[model samples]
Structure formats: structure tokens, C-alpha cells
Target: EPEVTQTPSHQVTQMGQEVILRCVPISNHLYFYWYRQILGQKVEFLVSFYNNEISEKSEIFDDQFSVERPDGSNFTLKIRSTKLEDSAMYFCASSRTGRTGELFFGEGSRLTVL
Candidate 1:
């Protein structure tokens, strides 16, 4: 079965640096989302994108963050300036439809801000 794939499973960066996390979502899926999990916290939705525009975004998706589907198969999240609080597992997810809310998550891009 097809699955979402993420790059650089782990990243160590200094606070205030920029980082671009990459993902290739399932080919036929439509809805895309980004979520993060801080070390002992529940998964928090960051943003959702569809049809070249943002569908939903949480407060966590502040000015420091942006997302793009630079290509037909690749989706990317760019952090303009990272912070210590940004250290977490950033998961790229996709769903066939929103009705089921079934998200298939990539292993994750672990961002470590020091």
C-alpha cells in the first residue's frame, strides 16, 4: 500500500534558524495536514491545505510557519525562524476524505531546537 514519506527523520538545529521539512503524501489522497507532538503532549494540528490554499490552521501556525505544495507529489513546511518550543515530532498526514478524519501519518521529522 502507498504511504506518506518524510525526509531527515531527525533534525538538530539551533534556535532561530530556518528549517524546511519535506514530505511526499499518498498519490491519490487529497486532504493534507501538518501536526506536531511535543515530547509528552498530545498531537496538535498545525495546518491543513487543499487546492493550493489553506483550509484550516491553528494558532500554533503562527507567522513563523508556512506550507507549500511545490509540486504535484511533494509537500513542504518551512519554518522562517525556529524556537526551542518547536522541538517536536512533525508529522505529515493525508486523508482520502475528511468525513472519516482518518489520517495516515509519516514516521515524522523530529525537530530538535537547541
Candidate 2:
């Protein structure tokens, strides 16, 4: 079975530095997303992409964050300026149809900002 893959299993960055988390979703899935979970909080939705455009995003996904499919296969999330609150496990996910379907998520890229 295919699965989402994320790089830099862990990352440490300065509070004002830029950070990029990468992911490779399942080859045939069309929907891609970025979600995050603070140390002891619930997973929160950040953004969703489809057809090369952002389909939906939450208020938490401010101007500082961005998502793109750089190479048709690799999806990336870029945080222009990392903040202490941005430290969390960023997850990349994809589903065959949409949110209602089973979403395959990567092991997650842990970001730690100081």
C-alpha cells in the first residue's frame, strides 16, 4: 500500500528563521493537506490543496505559512518566519476522494522553535 512520506523527521529552528517541511503524498491521491498538533493539544487543520490551488485553510494558516507541490509529486509547507507557537508535529496527509475518506498521513515532521 502507498503512504505519505515526510522528510527531516525532526527540525530545530530559531524563532525568526524560515522552515520548510516536505512531504510526498500517495502517487494517485489528489487531495493534500497540512495539519499540526501542539505538544498537548488536538490536531488542527492548517490548509488543504487540490488542483494545484488552496482549497481550504484555517485562520491559523496565516500569511506566514504556505503550501505547494513543487514537483508534481513532492508537497511542501513553508513557514516564512517561525514562531515559538509553531513548534509542533506537522503532518502531511492525502485522501483518495476527500475529507470523509480515509486519509493517509505521514509519520510527521517535528518542528522545535526556540
Candidate 3:
């Protein structure tokens, strides 16, 4: 079965820097999102995109965060400025539809801001 794929399984960056985490969701799924989870905390929703636009976002998704679906295939999350609090496992997930479909999640990209 097709699955979401993320690059640079682990990334280490300095605080106040920029970081881009990339992902390719399942081809047929439409709704996409980025989620963050600290080592032992519950998952935190960052943003969700559908129909080529942002559907919803959380307060945590501030000016420092942005999402893009540049090529109709690859979806990316760019943190214009990374902070220590940004260190976490960022997961990429998708659903066939925005509401009722089960979400499929990528293994996740680990971002470590020093």
C-alpha cells in the first residue's frame, strides 16, 4: 500500500534558525495536516489544508509556521524561525476527505532545535 514519506528522519538545528520538513502524503488522499508532539506529550494540531487552502490552524501555528503544497504531490511545513520549543516529532497525515475518513500518518520527522 502507498504511504506518506518524510525526509531526513531526524534534523538538528540551532534555535532562531529556519527549518523545512517535507512529506508526500498518499496520492489519493486530499486533506493534509501537520502535527507536533513533544517526547511524551499528546499530539498537537498545527495546521490543516484542503482544496489548496488552509482549512484550520491552531494558535501554535503563528507567523513562524507555513504550509505548502507546491507541486500537487509534495506537502511541506516550513518554520521560518525555529525555537527550542519547536523540538518535537512532526507528523504528516492525510485523509481521503476532510471530515469522515480515517487519517493516515507518516512515521514523522523529528526536529531538534538546540
C-alpha lDDT score of every prediction, in listed order? 0.94, 0.94, 0.93
Q: Could you tell me which 10 consecutive residues in candidate 1 have the lowest summed lDDT?
A: 94-103
lDDT tens digits by residue: candidate 3, 1-114: 999998769999999899999999999999999999999999999999998899999999999999999997999999987999999999999999887648889999999999
Q: Residue 85 in model 2: shift from native, Å?
A: 0.6
Model 3 misplaced regions, further than 4 Å: none
Q: What would the per-residue lDDT of candidate 2 be over residues 1-114, giving only the tens digit for each residue?
A: 788999989999999999999999999999999999998899999999999999999999999999989898999999988999899999999988875658889999999999
TM-score of 1: 0.97
Ranked by lDDT, top first: 1, 2, 3
* TM-score per candidate, chains pooled: 0.97, 0.97, 0.97
Give the alpha carbon lDDT tens digit for every residue of 1-114 in model 1: 899999979999998899999999999989999999999899999999988889999999999999999999999999978999999999999988876578999999999999
Please list all clashing residue pairs in model 1, or write none if there are none. Answer: none
